[model samples]
Target chain A: MSTDHLDGNAAAGALREIFTTDLTAATGTCASCGNVATVAQAVLYTNAPGLVGRCPGCEAVLFRLVRGPGRAWLDLRGVTCLEFALPDPS
Target chain B: MATVSRGFFGRRRSGDPDLPPGQYLVTDFPVLSAGPTPRLRTEDWEFTITTETGEKHAWDWAALMALPAQTPTVDLHCVTKWSKLGTSWRGVSLDTLFEDVESAAEYALVHSYGGYTTNLPLQDLLDGQAWIAYEFEGEPLEPEHGGPARLLVPHLYLWKSAKWVRGIQLLHDDEPGFWETAGYHNYGDPWREQRYWGD
Candidate 1:
């Protein structure tokens, strides 16, 4: 199976779609402390590998996917979208 | 995504402070920013600032350049672990940018392309040390390095020193950006080594 079908842009777009859709919708029991929380930021960078999310109540970094299979995927992931506020200086 | 033994905010093998002293150079530009003086093909370039209250100001290149410029020599520590020191950038200070605005927000979210973003304390944004740099190495900044204009907070990790920065939006609450939302330290305090996913 030729993987040439994935352009960096296309793959990035797909990831972005995931973030806006499934990733954003994901909420589960926190692996640490067994508290329910939401994913804050899904890290896609290799050096700082992991799926980082925050506890809704304690704000602790509960679920960490550091240094594992996901670590490898983060290396190849490209930034798809950046959400920020557009404040008016006036 | 190669993992370097050296982390952006981990203990150095030499045990030197994580922060760069004052004369190091981090040149991952060209391929990273833009290669050279990206020609402004048209009179369409604009730099704007937004407030947490949802106010915005747009400035053309000339208008932005018209703002007072200051030369600040600061140490830049990148999230990738390399620190460039003694770099002097001259541009408009954020205090000057938000001078006339009477917004009461306490924080600002810096926005940029390349899927990068970071948050800045309102005080830090107003810090005279912070500037929207247009020139580097005594020349116009290269686009790859946030040419024309880029936010340079010498005190914070270079990631917080956002590249290709187009605007700063004042915020009432602390909202994380692309990297911060992921696992990168929210504040990116170099002194605290708030560098990666968790502290």
Candidate 2:
């Protein structure tokens, strides 16, 4: 019963490296508990070895990102599908 | 015609020979966290050590406070590349806690109240290397800074000094905890600048 998790905004800086657009608004379904939420709404953990994004609905990890040394590794095994809210390019 | 791109130099590295590589000095302790800090009450809090053979050694808050306390001033280095030097803290040393517990395990995973965990060699936590710190700068630890009690393994990255610490689980084999399984280096040595998985 760890009383820890972080706000979604914490992932913004690290995620910006991999995505052209803000992915925080992107919604995704959780593979474990079938929860749906935006990246920002997930229970995030930043003070670890990497950034962990977990589902707010069931606490399942939605995505994991590790960034350093000019490289980044992202694992989406906890996610089922993602629907992005990209802005219209005129 | 050619296109130009941003030539990134790298993460900010300092030339300070004393501090760890790639770290900048921070006067304030940053509130880097997993989520919101778990509210841990000392009255209800207890520290436990689970040995590999199911032997459990535990101490309630009062019992823990009964032990001798040490005042240590040490530097802290975070994996995020921030170094806080000569931080003053008062707490019970892990050596005092492990005085009676007998274990043959080689590795240990430290667990905190809010479900956060990190692993290191059992030796890292003993021999005057670590503590269950409860006070900082002559003040009770605030929740944000892992108050109630937090592991203080200053030699390693600050993450190893888990916030709101509750117990230690000794294991026969290495079991990677939160960050170790995720992307942080298994053996996070600040001197080597082992921040990420590979380096």
Best by TM-score: 2
lDDT of each: 0.61, 0.84
lDDT of 2 by residue, A1-90 (tens): 555977778898655744876788878999999988888899887665568788898776788787766887788878998887654645
For candidate 2, the per-residue lDDT at B70 reads 99
Reference-based lDDT, residue B7, model 2:
34
Clashing pairs in 2: A2-B114, A2-B115, A3-B114, A5-B34, A5-B35, A6-B34, A6-B35
- What lDDT score is found at residue B43 in candidate 1? 54
Docking class for model 1 is incorrect
Ten consecutive residues with minimal summed lDDT in candidate 1 chain B?
A: B28-37
Worst 10 residues of 2 chain B by lDDT: B1-10
Off by over 4 Å in 1: A1-90, B2-42, B113-115
Residue B144 displacement in candidate 1 (angstroms)? 1.2
Of candidate 1 chain A, the 10-residue stretch with the lowest lDDT total is: A72-81
The candidate scoring highest on lDDT is 2
- Estimated TM-score per prediction? 0.61, 0.79
